[model samples]
Target: MRCDNGPELISAALGEWCEVQVIVLHWIQLGKPTQNAYVERFNGSFRRKVLNAYLFATLRQVRHLLTE
Candidate 1:
């Protein structure tokens, strides 16, 4: 997984979980958003199209919409 040095991603808990799962994390350098441009673009689109367009009351509703 390629990700920025965000607190959540850098947490010890997550690191341990990844270690157990055998997933290698690739960290992008600070101040370099271009390295993760694809995910950034997708996040922007998801926020605009789905998140901003809806008022979800539950995880089930969000999952239902996402599946469609």
Candidate 2:
């Protein structure tokens, strides 16, 4: 999985879990979001469609809208 260089993601616990599972956690370099354009694009789309389009009152309401 490709991720930004976030502190929580770089934690020892997550590192150990990834190691045990042989999961390659590819990190994007700092200030280099262009390297992860596809994910960034999807995030923008989701935010525009689901987030900006509504005023969600609760988690269940958000889930119901998405499921519909």
After superposition on all C-alphas, the RMSD of every candidate to the true structure, in Å, is 1.2, 2.6
TM-score of 2: 0.67
Q: Runs in model 1 with CA error above 4 Å?
A: none
lDDT tens per residue, model 2, 1-68: 88878676788888888989999999999999899999889989999988999998899999999899
Residue-level lDDT for 13 in candidate 1? 91
Q: What is the lDDT of residue 36 in candidate 1?
A: 100
| Candidate 2: stretches off by over 4 Å | 6-22
Q: List model 1 lDDT by residue over 1-68, tens digit each.
A: 89889787889998899999999999999999899999879988999999999999999999999899
Largest lDDT belongs to which candidate? 1
After aligning candidate 2 to the native by TM-score, how far in Å is the CA of 16 from where it should be? 6.0
How many clashing residue pairs are found in candidate 2?
A: 0
lDDT of 1 at 29: 91
Q: TM-score of each candidate?
A: 0.87, 0.67
Clashing pairs in 2: none
